[model samples]
Target: MKTVNLELFNNPNTVNKLSIAIKNESEKLNKPIKIMHICGTHENSIVRYGIRDLLPKSITVIAGPGCPVCVTSSKDIDAVINLSLKKNVKILTFGDMLKVPGTEMSFYKAKSLGADIKMVYSVFDAIELARSASKPCIFFACGFETTAAPTASALRDINIPDNFFIYSAHKYTPNGVYALLKSGKINMDGLILPGHASAISGLKVYERFVEDFNIPCASAGFESVDVLLSVLLIIKQINNKKPKIENGYKRVVNYEGNKNAQKALEDIFYLTNAVWRGLGNIDLTGYELRKEYARFDAKKQFDIVYSDNYIEHQKGCRCNEVILGNINPTQCPLYAKLCTPQNPVGPCMVSDEGTCKNWYDGGIE
Candidate 1:
């Protein structure tokens, strides 16, 4: 059982006070402040609870490449989709991956065309699936450090069935933010660190970003109050000219993070250059299976083929810009016209944590 926060930070009066503080702090700031957060679940909380609507107009909240499914390159998606098309091979994935765009089609579209694609919630499920499956099964794993740690743990403890293979698309969370800021893709005043992912990877990992950019960061939990408090803290930091890493969700996140989880990652995977859908390639940003675990890697074993073409995001889709904080989803020409959850033209719309999906579902004005 997990302990729940009883803080009434979301209380009408509490939120009202925080809102007042933000407005007052906004008035003290030199210019408009853009605070970027890179977590789909955090974005969901912000939109679902109307947190954006309560903030000062001068303060802007934007999202980065936090959603793992949204950042998956088209070539990777196409490769996995292609792998699913083969006989006696089923591609196991999360529900979100079903609708994500590949070359010209998606896994769901492939499944409709008779591709064997199975959706699983956890890696253990894939192991169980392999135990009973009559044919070869591959787990198309995708996520940040949080999900990666669990996958690593599963691989370390369980002897994967011969029919089981893994297609890893796991990424490191803080590294994504570092790449975004280093490349000048996202021009922001502060950062809202992901609580869940950071809980596994730790807050210390963000020390480099804070030192290099002098940006204020607060590891935030998924709650309206948590986000509101973080917003206030960031505003205070900017006003005081103090750039430091603060833990807004101190109950779960700590200075060091989860040690055992980190150990699993160190043992099972190694850092390497990874290509993001909209963000392009960033060095030491991706997690690949280690040499000892080569037998579990699906790409090497299957000899899968996919074009190296740079056809990642759709030309008209502003998902690339949205992730970089260059533009909003509404600013895109095809946002609601040609793209929606049911019939998505890009990965941003297909993923629930995607900026476009949250905006569309939350109906942000």
Candidate 2:
């Protein structure tokens, strides 16, 4: 969806040309090369366009902890669900988050059981609802930098109602990927940074990955050509033994990122340790409301507490391993057998950006 120009980028001639170049570059590498992309939109484009099939067998492109909904901790979901059940409060969030299973239930299930949960397209929508309603409304904000920027911007620019609050489950992408790479949980020779996230945080945040881990990094857009171009660039870096951050989606993403969005983030929120669904707690990766904005902090306003014994996945679900890129969706025992887009057993199958959902929709099976 985030393409420089869909008509231009998705041209058959350009795609074939890029694919040929990628295969040629990959042939130069003696060993198998794994490139992990930490963006759901990238995964969607890759699968939708069958980008993997175009690449040489030596090159493997895997999805990382990209989808914010897939990585949203069950504890946060449960907390919001409990809050929504209360008579005086209502919960609002993105549509993708409604179906994701919490420890006890999902927002959909809670809504079915008479809880005040609603799907809002944007943070401003929640504010509008709060403006007219007599009861308190809590926005269960979940996303990475791209979505977080708007929330921050709205809070900074809009006249928010006193009854409206934000329960931020927003995450910072770079630190999470860095932690996984450092912990040896993800074994990849190259990295493909997120396009939209990179546009906000910039390629500068990923400089440490190239410097410390010696991994080739490329920021890519969500187009067939963009994805292939990034792979080609990474392979070139691998062959030349010159690992650094490369900008493949330079049309939209800047090296320094959006300065105004960055400033708004700094002014509205602070970095703290946040819980990811499968990855546990990664330091300085979560965005929490600042002390000055305590009035709009849902956690502080509601006195909410998370459960110590929260369960992220079902018994047969391999979503944890899948989110970590340890395995693919088909490898899961319940992938197609029991878990599906129609009836998702794990968060990975629920969201449109989810790996399982993309694989299924792309007819991988």
Candidate 3:
């Protein structure tokens, strides 16, 4: 078989050919195949491009715990909100984080209440701002491996101010996925793994899941053709009864990933148990600033105690079920009714990469 280049799928004729290939494969499969794409960006692409509508009914593509913002605990949001509200402290974070709801308030609401909260495109900007500002600066760091490396890198050579600190809510994607699989929350026949995270963590990390769980896994790129090809590869693996890790996104991702980035992350942060919004506490899935960097750790510097008794979102939110692939975004009664992107009642509606946000923005009514 000829190796398919994702770039070629941009052509109408080539896309038609790929569609036919997928259809033929769909016809050959004995049972409906449920494949989960474990990236929030992938969910955005799927909903925006109407890829789900294009696919065969026999193939079900579900979204997983991909959005870092959607999965961030309410308590962590409350913690950052508290830090921002302090008289002399300034909070910095990526823009999408501002709207995510905590137990009592959001960053936007906190800012309204006279908290010095600011949104930044990158951690570098946050660091530069901290150097210029007179007040204490706290960066609310949140993301998977892809974003964590850069945050880790920023800590390497910089002379951090005495007032500068990091409230890290960064997480590891593979560990979270493994936890979900072990919990049986997701019943996926295979996984269409995240390309960006895989580019940092390497393809080797997923080898254990393939080996232990006997699930076919493929790393996918963000482009439409890349996703289509990844789905085809997954179908081929399932049909052949050979579970393995295949790399569909070869341009950016490799077997070992970016060594320099991995080294930076390992040097600064250590794995620890983390609390996820719907998933509860996942052991060794979270990263914390190393003991050597205690001076820069925000949690240690601030006399704050994050409460675990925060109330969950209102009943019928179905965020937990929607994230686990047990229910679609449309299945929730609050989906477009009470929980549209304009006024999100839940984190799923607020996050740009969230499944509900994707569906709402794409005019999926």
User: Model 1 over residues 91-187: C-alpha lDDT tens digits?
Assistant: 8999998898887788999999999888898999988998899988899989999889999999998788898888998888777778778878777
For model 2, how does the per-residue alpha-carbon lDDT over 1-365 read when each residue is reduced to its tens digit? Answer: 66344789899999999988887777789999789999998999999888998988898999989999999999899888987886568888999999999888899999999998889999989889999988899999999999999999999999998889999999999998899899998879899989999999999999999889999999999988899989989999999999999999989998999999999999999999999997799999999999999889988988797789999887888998999888999999898779988788899999988999999889887
Query: Roughly what TM-score does model 1 have, to 2 decimal places?
Result: 0.97
Worst 10 residues of 3 by lDDT: 6-15
> Which digits, one per residue and each the tens of the lDDT, describe model 3 over residues 111-132?
9999999999888899989999
Cα misplacement distance, residue 4 of candidate 3 (Å) = 16
Q: Rank the candidates by TM-score, best first.
A: 2, 1, 3
Model 1 ranges off by over 4 Å? 5-9
TM, every model: 0.97, 0.98, 0.96
Which parts of model 2 are misplaced by more than 4 Å? 1-4
